[model samples]
Target: MNAQTVIVADDHPLFRSALVLALRGLLPDATLHEVDAFDALQRTVESGIDADLVLLDLHMPGARGFSSLLYLRNEHPALPVVIVSGHEEPAIMQRAFDFGASGYIPKSSGLPTLALALRAVLDGEIWQPPQLKEAPAQALEHRELAQRIASLSPQQFRVFMMLAEGRLNKQIAYDIDVTEATVKAHVTAILRKLGLVRRTQAALLAQRLLQAENAALEVPAAEGLPVGEDDDA
Candidate 1:
């Protein structure tokens, strides 16, 4: 039988390890891949692993609230994603579903609930906390903006993320191994696609979506979970 494939994208080593441990019992024959941030998760999917599901952390580095969720829903429409987040706000959970998350699992959930959530998603069912009521109506303009951002090409998306990170054109060029002119072109395309007038506006938008929490609180190692070696392939 072909092994099932799952990607766990979380930065907390201990919690990620604990997740891996729980997942083993649920998908014993599955190939589990791990990633630390949104960029790594993007690269993994782009490399064509065809993961059955991705367990994503909402506050992971390189991701802003709904930004990564929008990108994944747009770019890999077939892939199922179950958000594994510390944030348990009903509004946040609702937004995840709106952005196409297959499920929302709070970090504090016990192993059995986690397993149940994963099983439901793998069986092609959408799962959110039963306690959460649907969020208030989202603005049409906001929905339109999400679709526009989702339309970005992978390279353009990468460039957009770098711009959000406050990297200069030359710095982005160096990091992505592209020429400065190419980076500039990507920036232009990204701005045009997002219907934005300037890089600062784009950056601010990313900040609002991706960095809602304080930067220092981004990647706390989960307490009481035993640490395990990272699996980044």
Candidate 2:
């Protein structure tokens, strides 16, 4: 029989160890790898580890935000990735889907739910534990926000969204491939267009807009899932 294999990535060693123990108990013969952050996770996968799925942390330092989600999906294509996060902010969760996460489970969810998410993915279905979706937030309008979004240029939009995540100016500059001065200029324009009072306001506006738009959209994965409706493992 083919042995199931999984990898868990988070910077928290103790937490990672606990999950490893639980997963080891649950899956028995399945192989598991634990990674501390994006670099470690990426390198481990690149080192030729055959992972059937990866449980990833979204907000860990160096996680590359949703970009790493895209990266992993891009690289493995068929590999399933279930987000293991402490942050259940709907926008981030939505972003995970946009980047092609197969499942999402909050760290606070008990082991049963985690196991269910893993099983669902293993069974060729995407999973998002219902309990995690109970988080409260004011609803925003998508079509209206899309109309508003038409005002920003592509570069300006990138800066605006990155800044909305509370990323520092330097980080935004680095991410958008512009001068810090250019980022500042873009920020100023974003503020002016949105009629914002401060950078914080702009950030908040961006957050609201992102949520309203439910901007997390699933791109077609670079690879396909396993070719059968059932598995013998």
Candidate 3:
């Protein structure tokens, strides 16, 4: 198998750089790219950069909540998206899932945890570690939404995420190096694919998925799971 390319996007330049450098050990020979905010995230992605995977910040500047995940899905639906966030709120995780994140990892998570999450998604498994939520109704709601959003293509997913982040179509097109007409076309397709009504509904669904996904990462490390920390591959 070829080394998977990975993009890490965040508002903090140093933090994002560190992640890219650190991840090289995880994906040696894997091309890495970094972008600071949602706008740059789109630009980096749409500029013909190649990546088999994306490490996206759920709350990067210019993008809020789970919208980034949605946008990535729309643009690169086949590419697995792993939520890289500083926030560990259960609700936040769930929203990531609702928006269609394949995995979720906290910033505090060490390389072992990051490796597990990344590999889990690449191996075609849901990337959440598992959690017990007190509210079954909330969990059920998220599952319903996840099922709906799961069918989106990467491009549709990216567009959906951006919409949830309160980004305008013009901004998205500019960032992605596409025409405004293309962005509108993508937005329409995203809505149809997710069976959503308004952009607000799509945004709400993204939030729910992200939160639901976050709720699932409560498991301890699995036995025999390879653990790597600060190792440069």
Candidate 4:
């Protein structure tokens, strides 16, 4: 049988190394790949790597809260993703499961519990901490918001995040290698899909739903500019 391929996506080098070491002991025959950022993880997936499971970190660079989880679930439905996060809040774990994570392993979990969670997920079973309880109403709202964000096309999603980061259309265009007009078009589509009327609203929604701390709602200098433009298109 082919060895299972696992991708570990986390930004903390020390913790990521520890997880990889634990994984090595747990799945001795499995092939493991490591990525330090959410964007790198996305690129790994986009590279057509055959992966059996993904160990994702929620607060990695280029990701926040459930956005990466939602995006992965949407773009690669067949790939099982297990969130390995430092956020040990029950609500966060419940939100992870609600967002379609195959498993949730807190960073504080002991080796045995981590092993169990990994084994269970690798065996195609959902796994969570024993202490996790029923989902709260806030979880449902976040899940709905995630679904709406997931509805965006991959490009639109990228633009959505960039918008939240207070990036202007020209900056986003430069980053994504698209024209300013194309960026504007994506911004319009993102607004329409999210049922919003302005760029600031989209930015605020992204920050609120993703729980992104660094992203700010920047008002563009001109109403005609992309980041602050109204949904006239």
Candidate 5:
């Protein structure tokens, strides 16, 4: 049988290294690839590496909130993604699952817990911390917004984010290394797909989605549950 391939995507060097070491201990025969930013991760995916899974960080450069997760879920529906984030709020965890994450691992989790969570996910089970009381439902508006964002082509998604950042078409062309005409075309498609009539409306909607996510993260950190143990363990 072939060994598994796992991509660890996180910007924090020290934590990423520790996670890699722990992953090595847990899956010694598996091939591991590391990327520090969302753009690097996108490049890795586009390179056709046949990764079995991706461990993604919630806050990474070139990605905002759940946009990265949405992009991965849209572009590669078969690939599994497990979110590893510092935020332990139940709402955030629930939101991750609602957005199609196979699992959510809080950064405070112990190595043993991390291993258990990975094992479950690799075995095709959706995993979350045992302390979660119930599944928090996502708002209907947020769900609709996510659906629209997920409908965009990968390049269109990038253009959408740049538009939200207030980058003009020329600036976006330079940053993405595409011609201005190409950017304009992407913008037109984005507007049509999102049902927005103008660029400013797209920007405002994107900002609204971002702010909603940021508010979820701003809620006081809930008390963390005991780590390294699951119901079946």
Candidate 6:
């Protein structure tokens, strides 16, 4: 049998090392990879490595909360991702599930617990803390937002992210190596698909998404869990 491939994307070396050690014990035949930044994580996944699973951290250098998760779900829907975060709040974990995460394991969990969660997820079962149940009303709103974000084509998604970064059409065009007119077309499509009129409105929506992510990151670290963490993949 082929060895399973897994990527652990987190910035903190010590925590990542501990997690990697646990994963190795749980998945003896697995080949593991580590990435400390979001861009590197994206590149690793996009390189077509046939990754079986990804363990992602939410507040990595290049990604904000849910953005990277949404990107992976949109771009590589088949790959399983389990978010490992310090924020074990029901709302945040439920949002992850609504956004299509295979599992949500709080950093406060012990290695044994993490192993059990991974085992369940690998067995094709969704795993989450019992307390992380979905709230229907809030779930509907988050699901709608996730769907809207996922609807963008790869190019359009890139353009949308650039817009969120406050890039103007000319700047976006230059970055994507497209003409400004083409960038404008992408912007229009993005707005229409998202049911918005002005670019600023879209930008603000993006900003709010980012703010939510930041807030989650700021959630007082799980009482005794290590610091330097937030959202997982």
TM-score per model over all chains:
0.67, 0.58, 0.63, 0.74, 0.72, 0.81
Summarize candidate 3's per-residue lDDT along 1-233 as a digit string, tens digits: 35777788877877887888778888787888777778888887788866778888766776644556766766577778888877776676666676578888878888888778877887878777444144233566455556566667666666766664667777778878888778777777766765554555555555544553353422122343333221111
| 122-173: candidate 1 lDDT, tens digit per residue | 8899987754645465455665665566677868877767666777777888
RMSD of each: 10.9, 14.0, 13.4, 4.8, 11.7, 9.3
- Let me know the TM-score candidate 3 reaches against the reference structure: 0.63
Give per-candidate clash totals.
1, 1, 47, 0, 0, 3
lDDT against the true structure, each candidate: 0.74, 0.68, 0.67, 0.78, 0.77, 0.78
Cα displacement (angstroms), candidate 4, residue 98, comes to 3.9
The ten-residue window of minimal lDDT in model 2 covers: 224-233
Worst 10 residues of 5 by lDDT: 224-233
Q: How much RMSD separates candidate 2 from the native structure?
A: 14.0
Mark the regions of model 2 whose C-alpha exceeds 4 Å error after superposition: 132-233
* Alpha carbon deviation, residue 50, candidate 3 (Å): 2.6
What is candidate 5's lDDT per residue for 1-233, written digit by digit as tens? Answer: 23789999999999999999998889888899999998999999889898988999988887777888978987887889999999888777766776688999989999888988889888888898864456566576655545666678878878877776778877889999999889888888887876666666666566655664444321112233222111011
lDDT of 1: 0.74
lDDT of 4 at 185: 94
- Any residue pairs clashing in model 2, and if so which? 98-217
What's the distance in Å from true for residue 25, model 3?
2.1
Local accuracy of candidate 4 as per-residue lDDT tens digits, 11-59: 9999999999998888889999999888898899999879999999887
State the lDDT at 86 in candidate 3: 79
Best candidate, TM-score: 6
Q: What is the lDDT of candidate 5?
A: 0.77
